[model samples]
Structures are given as C-alpha cells and as structure tokens.
Target chain A: MITFDKTTKTYDGGVTAVKGVDFTVEKGEIVVLLGPSGCGKTTLLRMVNRLESISDGKIMIDGEDSMSLDSIELRRKIGYVIQSNGLFPNMTIEENVMIVPDLLGWSKKDKKERFKKLMNMISMDSEKFGKRYPHELSGGQQQRIGVIRALAADPPVMLMDEPFGALDPIIREKIQDEFLQIQKEVKKTILFVSHDIDEAIRMADKIVLLRGGELMQYDTPSEMLVRPKSEFVREFFGKDRAIKSLSLHTIRELQDIIGLAEFDEGITDTITINVNHDLRNTLSMLLNQEADQVIVVDDEGNKLGAITIDIVQKYLHFEIKAKPTLVEKG
Target chain B: MDKWLKFLEINAPRIFDLTIEHAILVGAAILVALLIGVPLGIYLTTNDYLAETVLQIASVMLTIPSIALFGVMIPIFSIVNLGIGFVPAFVALVLYAQLPIIRNTYTAIRNVDPEMRDAAIGLGMKPIQRLFRVEIPNAFPVIMAGIRTAVVINIGIGVIAAYIGAGGLGVLITQGITRGDNYLIITGSVAVAILAMIADGFLMWIQKRYTPKSIAN
Candidate 1:
C-alpha cells in the first residue's frame, strides 16, 4: 500500500506540477490515475516509487516512510513501465527485462525461469523475442517488453505511465487486454497513468480522476462511468456515456412492445448485435444485414431489445445540444 | 618498393626513436583530454548554467594557432624551467585534441533519450550507475568518433612537434625542410600518412567491437 499525505512538488521554475495532494493505493488494487495532458497524473505516479521526490509531504509505502528507504532498494521492489516503453538501447530484449534481477544478483537458473514466465505472461515467447534487440522490435512489441520487464522481477508494486501510448490502435487494445489479464494473475498493486479516458475506463479497477494534479474523484470504473463526479470527467467520456447507458439498460427496458412472432431470424446469427455491444459494431451489423431493425440481447442469449435507425441516430448524436452533464462542486 | 626499403633502412632507427617520443607526448595528451575534458564535457552537459559556456571555451581553443600556442608556451615554460622540447609540443597537441573529445562526448551523452534516463532511474539505478552503465554505453559511438578525429589531427600535428626538438616524423620533415632535402620530406610525409592510416583502422575496429547490442541486430 502507498499513501501520499498533502504531497506538493513545485518545479524550480515555479511550475506547480502537484499541489498538496492526498491519496492512497491499497495493496493489489489496480488504480488508474486519469487526467488530460499537463494534469500531473504522471508526477503523482512517480512519487509512489520516489522517482520524483515529494518536496513538501510524506509518502509511505508498505508502512515505511518512502524517505527512510534506500532509493535503489525501494525502486527495485516496484515495476515501472514508463510511457514510450523506454527500453535501454544498449541491451537485448532479454537483458533489458533482466536488468532488475541482474542488479539483485539472482542466479542464472532463477533468472532464466523468471524470464520465461514473464514473457509468457505478456504473450511474448522467449524463443521469438528474447534474442532480439530493442531496435529490432516494432513499437507494440517494445511496449510488450516494457510491460513484462517491469513484472520480470515480480515486484509487489507496479507503475505504468501510458505504457502503450506509442502503439497503434489495434495493438494498443490487444496489449491493454493482455496487460489486464496479466494483472489479474500477478495481482501487483498497480498505478497506471493515462490521458485517455477510455483506457482509464477500460483498465482501471478504481479510477482516480486528476486535473491540475488534484484528485477529482476516485471510484470504481462502473461508478465513474455511470456517475462522473465532475464536468471534466463527464466531458472526457466524450458524449459516449449516455449512449453507453443503452449498454447498461436491460434489453427489456428498450425493447419494443411486440408479439414474439413479429421478430425475424434472418440475421440473428450474423447481423444483429447485443445491447452491450457498441453503436459502431451494431451499425456494422445493420449495414451487413441490410435490415431495418436489429435484435439486441444480454450477455446471455435472451432477448433484450431491438435497435432501429432512430436508436443509431441517437447514439451517433447528430443533435449536438441534447447532451448529459456531470456537476462538480468544490 | 626499393625506395620504401631504402627509406626504411636509412630512417628506421630514427623513426623508431621518434615514434616512442611522439607516442609518449600524444598519448599523454589524449589521456589528459579524456581524463579532464571528457568528464568535464559530461559534467557541463548536465549543468545548464555552464554547458554553453564550457562549449564556447572548447571551440575557442580550436581557434588558437597551434604554432602560436607552442610559441606562447615557450615563454611560460622558460619561466617554469619546463623547457621547450617535448613539454611545449605535448602541451600544444593536447590543447588541440581536447575539443573533439569534449564535443563528441557532450553531444552523445546529451542526445541520449531522456526517457531512457528516466527508465533507468525508475528501475532503481542511482545516478552514478546510470551514467556508467546506461549513458556511457549509449553515447560511446559519438565519443569514439571524437577520439578518431583527435587521433588523426594529432598525427598531422606531430610533424610540427620537431620544431621544438620533440622529434618524430615531424623531425624528419622539419630537418628536410631546412636542409632543402626532397627525399627526407617525402619519406616523413609517407611515414606520417601510414601512421594515420594504421591508427584510423585500429580505432575503427574498437568501434565495431564495442557497439552496443541494443543499437544493432
């Protein structure tokens, strides 16, 4: 667990990156520090491992004040995945991942075992990626190495600063999903930083919305989505929150009143979409089916609702003025 | 071929003697530059207040005429009783060599991605460890290039060292010049050229050997 009590950091040039912040991360909690750019989300994350010293306040990790611990020892216990991967240029992929363990003087046998286990966790097989150098890897592959390298030593704490930022969209999503799966198993207390709301929404077990280095709200992803605590958080969801409400709604809530016979089965298997599925996915389904109405269902196969052209229009929201707002006070 | 053998037979002893003397001076100068200048350059790189100021000093050093520098040193050494020969010539050549090493070391270390620096720190490396293990390895190519430039230029300057009685092939050339002997001038010129070629090749080999695995396949 990590705790920050009234932490403040003002750069020498008098730029206040963080101003008197208070927060805590419980053990094994995957906390995403979310914000728009220049929000100091990264600075807060760095404070956990003391990469950036807290100038004014105290940071305690695992019941020890961060100031009391030897910085090298403290950092070795934390997994840090910096934005843009940051693989050392002088090392091969295996060596880059092996840095911490090599520093700790882990025996060659244990190192080899951990190397295979970590690469496997991140879906990078040792045979294919181990011998390659950092420059030899594509962007996504480098990000994968960055993620796994941090976890290589199996530290109890993990900090990822937009680790997948340089990756393409498809690869980013794949890595995100892969990282989440790895997280579930490794169960390290994670602090992930991201400027993108959707990533924070998707990845965070608990979202800590930060603006100007101050905590706006820290809550569950579902809670943050359904009830954003501030206008900033609401705006970041980008008009998708209300539309996402359809996903949350029981299919019965949006289903048209009709006899069971009225429904058609022509596109049931290939064309119709589920209520939980996105408007973009559903639109693709409609286009493919060339049908007017699409059947929607729950995660189970039970009937939920029907999505028509009107619902698609509402989801797309060409009518700009009709939008939801989240109020913030204090 | 016979011309080479005759030149070798006539000057071989002198070449060997002068080479030992030249090697000591140039080698000392380069060592001093690497010792005092390279680290100084790295230090300046990390300090915003002094970086540009120190670079300006190094650049200005390049502008100082090598002959005039040796000439200036004569008076200073005369007072100190360090005398003219090897000391003055060594001092001049060392001054000339410092710039390339300093500039290249500074640029290479400075240009390394800050993200990598942060990552090293994030992974628990102290600043000193980061410098030696991460920054130095990353910046070596540039630093090696500086050394190559220094070595080549100093070889050319080694000829001038004979004016102060710090004999090398330069001694042969200077003696050939004053005596109006074409054979002596030609022999010293060819010898210096050969020395430069050999040194260039040697450093190139080192550069290839130490190139980081991460930067290459």
Candidate 2:
C-alpha cells in the first residue's frame, strides 16, 4: 500500500537523517522500522506524513506521491501514534479520541458513534470514562486510547512510533498482545518504528533494519533472524537468534512438521499449554517447570497430545535446517 | 485607635471611590497588556531571536523602579500634550505588566509538552487550529497566572498613579505625607493591600475556572 522510492531526509548543515531508503509496505501488513537511536527510523516514518519534510526522492502512498497532496490532507488520511500516547490533556477521553473526526467536521452524532465504537474496541466503557481526562487513565489505557484515537477516522494507513514504549515491561507485553488482537480486526497498513528487537519480531510482518540512516536489510522477521544478510544484522538480532526465531513459529507448526509425543496419563506432575502458544514460550515453560512433558490442548481444551523438551529441540533442529534451503530455492 | 476608626469612618466614602479608580486603572492596564503581551508572546514562541530580544527587553523594563517607569512615561506621553494624569499612569502600568504576562505566556506556549505539539501536527491540525485548540488551551493556566501577577503588581503600583493626579488611593498617602496625617496614609496603604488581595483572589478563581480540568491538579 505504501512504497518508499529512495526516500531521504536531510536537515540543515549537510546532515542526512535518512539516506536514500527504499522499501514497500504491503496492504494490511505491519512493516516495522527497526534500528538503534539516531538510525533515522523515526525520521523515515515522519516523512510519510510530511511531518519531517522529504528532501530527496518520493514516498508513494496508494499510488499517489505524498508531496503531491496537501500536507494536512495527507496527514488526516493517515493515523499517527507516538511513544508518549499524546492525548490532549485539556480534552476529555471522548474529545481526545474524536479529534480527527472533529477536524473532519463530522456531525456530533457521527463523532459520538465513532467515539463509542473506538472506546468499545479497547474494551473501555464509553459512559464510564467518556468525560474523564487523559491523566485519569493508566498508562496502558491511555496508550490504548492513543491507538484507537488514530484509528478514530478509520484511515487506511498508520504510522506508530513505539506506541507502547513508555509502559513497564509486563504492561508493555500485555498491551502489545492486545494491540495485535486489535490489528486482527482492523488490518491497517502500518509503518511502525521500534527500537525493541523483540517487539519488531512479534509485531512486524516485515522488518526494515537500518544503521546510521542506511537500510541494513528488509525481510520477514524469520528470514532476517535465520539468514542475516550482514554481520551487523546478525549482531543486531544477537547470539540467541536461533532461540529468538522460535517466537515466530507456533506449536501448530511444530506439530505439523513432526507430530507430538505420546501423553502419559500417569505423569501427574505436568502442565497444559494451548495449541496456539509459540514454541519459544513452550520451550521456556518446559525448562521452567522441569516436567517430563506438557499436555497440549486445542481451543476447546481437547488434549491433542503431550510435548517434551526433546520434541521441541527436534522441531527446532528441523526448522533451522529445513527452512533456509526452502527459502533459498524459492 | 479611636482616632483611626473616626478617620476611617469619615473618609470611607472617599476611600471607596479611590479604590474603584485604583481598580479601573489596574484592570484596564491588565486587559490591554493581555491584548498585546499574549499575542506577542505567542508570536515570540515562533521566532527565537524575537523571543530572546523581547523577553530581554521586558526583563530590563521590569527592573526599572515602578516610580522610575512612571517618571519616564511622563516625558514620553507629555510630547503628545497630555502626560500628567491617567494616560501616563495607564501606559506605565501596561509597560510594567508586560514582563510577567509576556514572559509567562511565551514560556507556557513554548514549553507546551513538545509531544503534544508533535501529535497536533501529526494529526493534521492546521497551524491556526493547533494554536487555538491545542497550544493556547494548554497554555491557559500559565497565561492566567501571568495576568494575575500583572494585575496584583499593577494594583499596588496604581497607588503611585495618584502622584501624577490619576486619582487613586495614593492621593491620601501622598497628601497625608505632605500634611503629616498618619490616618490617611494608613487608610490608603491598607485599602490598596485589600484591593490587591481581592483582585488576586478573583483572578485565581478565573484561572481555576478556565484551566483545562485535565491538568488542573
């Protein structure tokens, strides 16, 4: 849905914050701009909304050059979220969420309806919290409001700059899961900026890695993890890349590749995990509980079979060895 | 004590009139200062050099003794043939008020959480729309505070305006000093003090009433 054609940003004094970066974000896919600080990930994202003016080349959104449209008009058509969850402190929750709609001149009734729907999406009761200000909510709730506020106008595109970066780790993880759940219902074409490697791996359909304003690599999280294009890419993912890659594969993928081990009913000291749980968590669970096996259940709590440490290792071996060749051949 | 009370009872009417005059002088100065300082402050936020220059000038102006400022205003306004009374006093008060109003306004608007400004820009708010709806509203409490400071300071200084024949409580004090009547001086000083407190209290109410509830605490 969005294509960056050698997009570049040069500030005064001959300093380039974003160098000739080229990438494409597919429709309804989350493309995360992943880089360390000063790598220009944020500068690139801001260029899309013309917040940071593009100095050279172009960014095409929905086949139209971004610069060709009025900056304000282009921005209104896109959702924007920042790390601070920038809800207007002066406005109540309802007014803050309905900002874009108000800007669009939507009727009061229409704005109220959209506000209700957005509050509902975050599972926040509109009547209970509508008149409350941004400070009244917790960090996570405020971030949720920030997200829905962007989604308020139902813009086709979204630019999120570490929307959950401010929350504590536990809350951050929970909100990240909640955001992903929301994304499933509203599949926006998103350009996400994140310095957190784990967040990019978990949320992005594609990761655009950068270093010092230069594009390091752009590929699926798994591809980038498994077959890094450069030494920096490998280092960026870190020494536990094989283990980190486990997060991208689910229990279902492992079951399909190599069937689960038999369930021993006599093994009373065991735990159960859902079938949809990622292999990384499953591995951690196995190690943490030190149980012989874990009973794996489907959505309806039907026990499919049991899985063990040995089975996870075997699947990991199969995945690491088998996928690279397939990717190469493809 | 009997002499003080009797003096207060006798001059109560005159004191009331002077208090009203004192209030009008301060009020008009603050109102005009708001009109000038607020916009100038907002404008300064957009221009760095101008903000520095204007704030520095205001600071220097603030350091001038209110009496000295009133003194300077005499000659400046006299060139127009009407320097002695209300005009010089009014202009002097406005000049004195600028430091607080402009400084607070410039700082408040300039310091509005940058994240908020970025969000406003990102959400596609027009420049004017952002200024009115986001920047100014968020900056309200501080701007009101500046006005309050200006009002309180001007009320005290408004007493000085009577020296130039502007007709405020200062007349009692100045004339009493000339004639050696401590009763008039005491009444004038106490009256001015009460007026400052009441005016500040009124402004405090306004600041609270209009400050965005979200950040009021």
Candidate 3:
C-alpha cells in the first residue's frame, strides 16, 4: 500500500510539474495515472519510487514515510519497468532477470530457480533463452524479460511507465493480458502511467485522472466513464463512454442481471464464448455478423444460453441509467 | 634487389633488436595513456564544460606534428635533466596517444543508452557498479577501437623518436639517410609497417575476445 499526502514536485526553474496531490493505493490494486502529455501523471508515478523527488508533503509506503528510508534501499524494494523495456544488451536474458538477486548475493541455485520461474510466468522457454542476449529475442520477448526482471526480487510494489508502449498493437494487447494474469497471482501494489484511455480502462483497478499537474478525478474506470466529474474528463473519455464502460462488465454480470438469451438449436451457424468474456467484445461479436447464434459457456464447458445484440444494448441502458450506485465489478 | 637483400640478411639481427625496442616504446606509452586518459575521459562526462575544454586541448595536441612535439618535449624535460632520450620520446608518444583514447572513451560512455543507465540506477546499482557492469561493458568495443588507433599511430611516431636518440627501428632510417643507403632505409620502413600491422591485429583479437557477444557483430 502507498499513500500520497499532499505530494508535489517543483523543478529547479520553479516550474511545477505536479502539485498537492493526495491518494491511497490499496494493496494488490493496479492504479493507473492517466492524463495528457505533461499532465504530471508520470511524475506522480515516479514519486512513489522516489525517481522524482517530492518538493513538498510526504509519501508513505506501507505506513512508513518514503523520504525517511534510504533512497537506494527504497528503489530496490520497488519493481520498476519503463517504455523501452531497458534490458541490458551486455547481459544474457537470465542475467538481466536475475540482476537484483545477484546484487543481493543470492546463491547460484536460488538464482537459477527464480530465473526458471520468471521465464515460466511469461510462458517463454527458460532453457532456450536463458543464455541468449536481449538482442537475440524479438521485441515482444525482450519486453517480457524486462517485466520479469522487475519482478525478480519479488518486490511488493511495482512502478510501470508504459511498459508495453513500444510493442505493436497485437503484441501490446497480448502482453497486457499476460501481465494481468501475472498480477492475479503476485498481487503487488502497482502504480502505472499511461496515455491510452482504452489501456487504462482495460488494466486499471482505479484510474487517477490528472490535468496540468492537478488531480481531476480518481475513480474506477466504470464510474469515470459513466459519470465524468468535469468537462475535461468527459472530453478525455469522449462520447462513446457508454460503449467504453461495457468493457468493464462481463457476460456473467449481464447474465446474472438480465439472464442470457435462450439457446436456439435450429441455427446452423453458432459460436461459443466463455462466460467471463467482456460485454464490449461480446457485443462486437454480435455486431460483426460472424454467426447466427452466440452461446455463452461456463468454465466447465457447460452450454449456458445464447446472447444477442439486443441483450447487450438492454444491459448498457440498464447499467447507465437504471443502476443507482457504483458496484465494483472486478 | 640483391644489394638490398644482402643488407637485410646482414642487418637482420640488428633489425630484430630495433623492432623489439620500437614495440616496447610504443606499448609503454599507450599503456600509460590509457591509464590516465580513460579515467579522465570518464570524469569529463560529468561536466559538459570540462569535457569540451579537455577534448579541445587533446585535439590540439594531436594536430601538432609528432617530431615537433618530440622537440618541444626536449626543452620542457631539460629542466628535469631528462632531455633528448627515451624520457622525452616516451612523453611525446604518450601525449600523441591521448586524443584518440580520451575522445573515444568519453564518446562511448556518454553515448551509452540513457534507458540502460536508468534501469541500472533503478535496479539499485551503485554508481561504480553501474560503471563497470553496465556502462564500461557497453562501451568496450569503441574503447578498444580507440586503443588500437593510438597504438598503431604511436608505432609510426616512435620511429621519429629515433631522431632524439631513442633507439628503435627509426635509427636505421636516419643512419641510412645520412650514408645514402636506400636499402637500409627500405628495411626500416618495411619493418615498421609489419610491426604496426601485427600490433593492430593483436588488439583486434583482444577486442573480439572481450566484447559482449550480443553486440559483437
């Protein structure tokens, strides 16, 4: 857990980059700092790691004042990933991932086991890639090593500055999904910085919106999308916020609220989707005319029922208008 | 051709001794240059103003003709009572080698990817640890290139040191010139050429051996 109590940053030239911000990031939550360029979102994220020094106020990490700890020791305890991936070209993939452990003087056997486990997390073959330098791998693979290198020490807090921003769209989406799965198991407190609203919506447990170094709104993706606090927030999310919020709702939620459409047997063309798939994607499948029938299935592959475009729209209207208060979806 | 071959055959032992002398002079100068220049170059990286000034001075030193610099060294070292021998010649060669070694080290370390440096610092590496493990290894190839250049150029310049009574292969060239012996002069020139090539090849092998395999190509 981390708390920013009236945090601020003023540069040497007296230009303020971040100002008087306060928030608490709960344990195991992924809080994304979202804003336009130069909005100080990155500065705010960096302050938690003490990368950018706070000029005023205090930052508390796990109930201790961040300034009170030695800066080197403080950074070691926090995992950091950047946009460029930042893997050392001189070191092999295993060496890059095991740098922190090496610094801490871990035994060779322990380092090797951690290396293997980290490799498995990203589903990359450890034996094949361990001895290879970073350049030998593809861009996506290098970034995976970058992410795991940060996780090597198993730090309780992670700071990511657009960790996947360098990859192509397809690979970016794949890695984001991969990282989210990793987060499910590790459950580190993460403060992420990103410019893409869709990425924040997809990954953030809570989004802290900023504008010109000031806090605009800090809320869940769904709440921010459904009820924007300011005109800037509305404009930032754009007019399709109702559709955007659909991504946060899953097929299971929709089915539980209004129930799925009855499975029709006569339709020759049909496709099956998992019950946990997001409503926005399900809506896309329905609108794409890929099939005459779409069936929702439970984890056991038990066929539940059919879902159509009408049901998604019904839910969208119900979620936006009929719902009285924000209920956390996950 | 027969006369030149006979001169080479008769002078072979002397030529061998002079070549060894030449090699030691160049090698010693470059070793000292590296010890001084490399750390100085690294230090310059922290101060932009100092870097520019120091690099400019080294460049000016390089532009001075080798023999003229050797002559200048004679007067300066005379005050220390070490003029016109190995000391002045060694001093001159060391100065000449400085530009390449210092410039290359500075450029290589300065050009290390900022992201890599950030990662090193963020991962809790001390400044010294980052220098050796991250910055120096990344800068290895270019730094070796600089050393190779300095050694090769110094080999040629060391021949000129013979003018100051620093015995080397250049002694043969000067002797042949005074006595009007083309064969002896050609022998000296060829030996110096062969020595330069051998030194360069050795340094290249060292570079390939130590360079991080990932960036070898």
Please tell me the TM-score of chain A for candidate 3: 0.96
All models, DockQ values? 0.67, 0.92, 0.82
> Which candidate do you rate higher for lDDT, 1 or 3?
3
lDDT of 2 by residue, B29-101 (tens): 8899999999999999989998899999999988888788888888888899888999999999999999999
Clashing pairs in 3: none
Runs in model 3 deviating more than 4 A are A323-330
Q: DockQ for model 2?
A: 0.92
Per-prediction TM-score to the true structure, in the order listed: 0.86, 0.96, 0.97
In candidate 2, stretches whose alpha carbon ends up further than 4 angstroms from where it belongs are A323-330
List TM-scores of chain B, every candidate: 0.93, 0.96, 0.97
Tens-digit per-residue lDDT, A64-101, candidate 1? 89899898999999999987788987888888999999
Tens-digit per-residue lDDT, A1-330, candidate 2: 999999988999899998999889999999999998999999999999998999998999999999899999999999999999989999999999999999999999999998888888888999999999999899999999999999999999999999989999999999899889989999999999999999999999999999999999999999998888887898888878788889998999989989998899888887789999999999999988767669999999999999888899998777774676334622
lDDT of each: 0.79, 0.91, 0.92
Clashing pairs in 1: A251-A304, B159-B170
Task: Fill in the DockQ of model 1.
Answer: 0.67
Ranking by DockQ: 2, 3, 1
Ranking by TM-score: 3, 2, 1
